[model samples]
Target: MRVLVCDDEQLARDRLKRLVEKADNVEVVAEAANGREAIEQTQEHRPDVVLMDIRMPEMDGMEAAEHLSKIDNPPAIIFCTAYDEHALQAFKVHAVDYLLKPVSLSDLEMALSKARTLNRVQLAELGKEVSEEKPRRRGHISARTHRGLELVPVDEVRYFLADQKYVTVCFSEGEVLIDETLKDLETEFGEQFVRIHRNALVALRYIEGMELATAGHHQVRLRGIEERLTVSRRHVAGLRKVLQSL
Candidate 1:
């Protein structure tokens, strides 16, 4: 069984790596310092199980596990934390097991055995439960590409353009296709992004200004990119007000 260990503390990760190495037939695939790295490592390694820490900076373990659950053949999660308060929340996300801090080798092995038995259907069910709850406003958005899963930091994203069923995420570096609806994106990132058109959402921080494109039509100019997006008639007034405030 392949395993990834994630913890904020380097010592904790080292200890877990040692314990994981001792487990029969289990290899320590990778180690992550926080939840974002955990997700990236999981994407790269495709581990069968993840030993996660709950309280982490940037992104927490629960949020990372929720994101991972949406992927194909998701690895089973086993949360390891010092606080017992997070146990209920851990089980709510359908963790394979929850081990308290200073985890024992025997307990970890049992959890790994349980993780190995989790079928796709079980992981699917967990994903559904996570989706039913209020969608988390993430610091980063994930996209599945031929290379693998790509993570785009929300702060760096300039805009989201919806073309039929797919949403194109324009970031500082480049753009990537994501499997998210514009309406859902609007709902999740309403504070940071504004609906400029029916098919587009522009980041408030990236908005340079609005210009008249043609007779009675206007387009928004973004800071990082030259491509100007058409702003709908209904949203023109609101967008102008947003720009004024900025």
Candidate 2:
């Protein structure tokens, strides 16, 4: 099996590479220093499995796994971290296994044996777990594009517009389509965003003001974008209360 080694520290990567090489029929395909590189290398190399570290600069493994899960025929994820606390979160993202630091060759080999692509049902179940766990909000949001996985800083997001089955994340530069539900997005980012309508959530910090858009209808003006989103009458009072505290 082809494997990608991802860890911030050189020593950790080296050790993982050595152990991976020891496994029967397994070869070290590439190495990545952080979660961002991990995703890039995975896209370029098409590794069968990734030995992922949970904590790293730029992006954490959990967030990286979320992005990887979107790719076509995503590589199996096996989290290798020093901390034990993230084990649940690791499995929540559908990792093949969780291996702690100072990993043993036997454990690594056993984990490698379990590598397999996740099915749509498993991915759907993971989404449900993510929403239910209310995992710590990530700093950036990831979307798969033709070029590969793109990371959009959560702070740059102007708003989230939900259609039937997809949510469009509008950030400072542009917009990207994502599979997350609006309700799940609101639940995870409630502090930073507010629901303006059943179909939309606007960034609290980006709200320029509110005004009447048409007869008996209201719209919200956001700072970075020209388009004005309609504010549902039912949510207007709640939006006002949230805005007042901000």
Whole-model lDDT per candidate: 0.89, 0.86
Residues 219-245 of candidate 2 have per-residue lDDT tens digits of 999997899999999999988888788
Q: Tell me the tens digit of each residue's lDDT in model 1 across 1-246.
A: 989999999999999999999989999989999998998899889998999999999888988887787677888899999999998888888788999989999999899888878887887787767755634677888787776767788999999999988999999889899877898889999999999999999999888899998787999899979899999999999998988888
- How does candidate 1 fare on TM-score? 0.89
- Winning model by TM-score: 1
Residue-pair clashes per candidate = 0, 0
Supply the global lDDT for candidate 2. Answer: 0.86
Please give the TM-score that candidate 2 achieves against the real structure.
0.87
What TM-score goes with each of the models? 0.89, 0.87
Clash count for candidate 2 is 0
| Regions more than 4 Å wrong, model 1 | 128-135
> Residue 15 lDDT in model 2?
92
